[model samples]
Target chain A: MDRNRRVSVEEVKHIAELAHIKLTEEEETLFTEQFNRILDYFSKISEVNTEGVPLTYHVLDLINVYREDEVQESLGEEEPLKNAPKREDRFFKAPRIV
Target chain B: MKTGGIEEKRALSKLYELTAIEISEKIRNQEISTEEYLYSILERIGQVEKKVHAFVTVVDEKALEKAREIDRKVRKGEKLGCLAGVAVAVKDNICTRNIRTTCSSRMLENFVPPYDATVIERLKAADAIILGKTNMDEFAMGTTTETSYFGTTHNPWDLRKVPGGSSGGSAAAVISEEATVALGSDTGGSIRCPASYCSNVGLKPTYGLVSRYGLISYANSLEQIGPLTRTVRDCALLLSVISGHDDRDSTSVNLAQKDYLSFLQDDIKKLKIGLPKEFFEEGVEEDAKGPVFEAADKFEDLGASCHEVSLPMMSYALAAYYIIAMSEASSNLARYDGLRYGYREENDEGDFDTVFSRNRRIGFGAEVRRRIILGTYALSAGYFEQYYMKALKIRTLIRRDFERVFKNVDVIIGPTMPVLPFDIGERIDDPLKLYMCDILTVPANLTGYPAISVPCGFRNGLPVGLQIIGKPFEEGTLLRVAYTFERNTDYHKYRPSL
Candidate 1:
């Protein structure tokens, strides 16, 4: 475990920003300490000699599976938009980005 | 000449005590109506739900309607499915059509899916009555069910202690006889952990063996929906109903299905069971270890051979598992941005990023936010190679380690959890310390091997689980071994006095 690798408040804020989450001042301070400890525990992976090992993204022995390009009856627009917190007609309403 | 009230209560308790298989037989033979069976379970739930807090929502009306339909079909002499008339509770993380599947989080508190999960469809096809949704850790994140927004599910054996989670409610439901069987998803020991703490049987099927089509993804690559039941035979029956190919889930294998119940022979003669030394070393409590070793001796007495094996790379499995799971969770949980389904902040009339951030901040709990933040950091540009990639490489090594060990031994056996059920709120604040409890169970999830947690013994009135890991898609072997141990021991027979 490397002490130099401890996460800082700035890093925690940046990570939260990237994760689309807003943290309060108290939460930011709390996460800074918790992240450092958890990351320090994760640092143990560096000890393993994985020099020639390939990264396993998935455990199954499957490749890209292609389904037939057939039009099928799926959920209607109303069904999906039913749970939207704010929906205008059939489309989900969101804050303007531009 | 006992009191009528006491006699009636005893009869009802006896009815609730019958195994799912026996109840199904009685239903099929017209000795008991499916409606009566369901009423008995619902009655018991009404009795203990306040103490246990096992269910997030109980679909009383819908369950009765379905039970009546099954009973009507039974009276007509029509064919019934394998699980006909059985009461099955599903973890809230798995989607249910027209039923609110809240994943124990406020984020999806009012969100109802328009579709059922593949396993739910299978259970419906088997005529299994869906009792209701069980509580869980919010987004299946915590080891104990305390993180649930609904409330913590108490361990049936001792209400003060936690039933291990994130499938805590499902395991508690079974142990308390609220439901005959349950479906729980295990990202890293969610099912087995609760099963251990509750003294029930849970199986995490080999990845891709069971379809994950409708399971709300906590970690897409690491989690698999599994069964939790009071008996190994019921576990196998539930597995048979749910296991198979689904084109909807691309990762699901198109393997031939077998009647898992047929593998329940009491004979493990000439079987090769490996006792991994890393699992039983220091950190494992003596109370938890004693029963597991005794179980190994029991296997040896049953004419099976037990050997001490080593999966040295297992020491790094916890690190690798959390890194991978949290990274995946950060990505999977990014969909709850207030625009689509889930909780939303209506008054946020700011920029898109502000709305998204605010929605998530208010929607997610502390643990979920922590994992999402850490995961984003792990995958960040400068840190990807150092954290995320390193964890994946270690995952490869862990997989290879299991592959190498499986060639010599048919199965690896060890304690499911390193400690007995801790008092609720003991480690809730210390997230890192809480993660340590999963050390022994995460290796199977990392390697995509099938594993099961069966009650082996008790410690100071709390239960200990023995975990058996088998080769990929070799759940038959795992169930066979579990069945043997369960038959030879009376550990699973001890029910909570609640």
Candidate 2:
């Protein structure tokens, strides 16, 4: 097991790619150190005796937050849109969606 | 009455009460000019904000323009809305049209929303001045404001101590008079914690009461936007303006609100207030507990009965909150791809991997990235059942614990935070130490109940927030009890000499 190691720059780059983030060289180096330390800390979780203990995620026991299915009126034209750099024909024009 | 010997009249003239209802009344009666009020607050911000660091971005030009428009309308004898020309500091999480809504994360540093958040639209419609975007824990993840990409907000009461977070900046702004009132989002005591630390009033409106359309989601199930002000009346007034159903947010409840401020005047006789025994147990700070008990004494003076109720699982709420909040946050923050919106870098080298690699790494902060990794691991395929599902079941138990207690009491009183405000760097090195600060306030979020943190008393001259937890959608009763406490005590009126 390669336990005595910091995450490689290559590995950090890979993780950053997977996470969809752009990293500067400084960030990659910084996160590599930080991530290694964090991963080391997370290793403590494995030490807990959970032979029968269930892994818990959400604290709220809510089964589902459901709302009654109903149709509602839209704001129609009464809605006044403000703080736009530009607007056109009751719609906010922006950079192409595609 | 004199603040710093600057003359009582000057201090009073400079003082901004953080409620739309009060501001509207004054604006309508021509008691104060909107321009006078707006610039006066801006000047106050300039005076005190250096140490407090309450705002991430101050929209001075826009805020002044909005105030001037309100002044113009008032001069023309136009009918005023509910909160004409009131200055409102928005939490960085909520999207503001053309305004950078960073959520205090590096991810959205340059991202400007193309449209106003629903609450922003509502606040603007009420003729409120958008003061600025206040700082927070990056993506509303931490209990202390230390997790912010912009750095921590100082407690106004004590410059060295922290204002509770991730709504710390908002609470500090209100306390230091940077803005009259500020909008804050609470997933797990973000609003209340800061409000408690800063000696201000903060409310976590019942889930679905306030529209969450434009709020940057930290934890979808737990998040609700509310106000942090200096008085309970301001919270009630803000609630009336912001709480309503919106088509954009399907989870919004269409329930009608009676005048919450009117409900504040109701008699407190025969009201059952629960004192959770588990909260006051050993490990609770002696200083914090003393003020909490004093607050309980005040509640008793208001003709309300206080009884100790047992919530055995309440002890594990902080641990459970972190697990659940991080898991949800990991999922919610996945949207900031840096491709569509928020700080996207130009990647001329064309691979999809390269595009994502350059974008997210530069965009997100260390805390956000850490949580994302933690959440990803928790919600991943194999660990889902062991971690996420089990937490959900325990969450049920936590909620049941509150439900059982609330059945015997109309409200529960406890310390909003378990300790006095720690200095800036006290818990920065230890993440677990930071997470422990939410011990007293996470239960309300876990139970999906409405809780308020109002100024109780001072502990060594620093502010203490007393939390009033009520049943779901029973914000009226919570406000009534809080208002009663505020009216009977001078705790809310205590201003920092700074």
Candidate 1 lDDT, tens digit per residue, A1-98?
34475777888888899899999999999889888889888998888778888989999877799889899898976899989999888788888898
lDDT of 1 by residue, B1-498 (tens): 122477665665666777789888998998777876777898899999999999999998999999999988987889999999899999999999999999999899999999999999999999999999999999999999999998899998999999999999999999999999999999999999999999999999999999999899989998999999999999999999999999999999999987999999999999998998999899899998999999999999999999988988988899989998999999999888878899898686789999889989988999999989888888899889989999999989888888888899999899999999999999999999999999998988888999999999998999999999999988999999999999999999999898
How many Å off is the CA of B472 in candidate 2? Answer: 0.4
Listed in order, the DockQ scores are: 0.86, 0.17
- Cα error of candidate 1 at position B336, Å: 0.8
Provide the overall lDDT of each model, using Cα atoms, as 2-decimal numbers. 0.92, 0.78
TM-score of chain B of each: 0.98, 0.95
Candidate 2 lDDT tens digits, B426-460? 88766666767787888888777899998888878
Could you tell me the lDDT of residue B116 within candidate 1?
92
Please report how far candidate 1 places residue A35 from its true position, in Å: 0.7
Alpha-carbon RMSD, each predicted model: 2.2, 5.5
DockQ of 1: 0.86
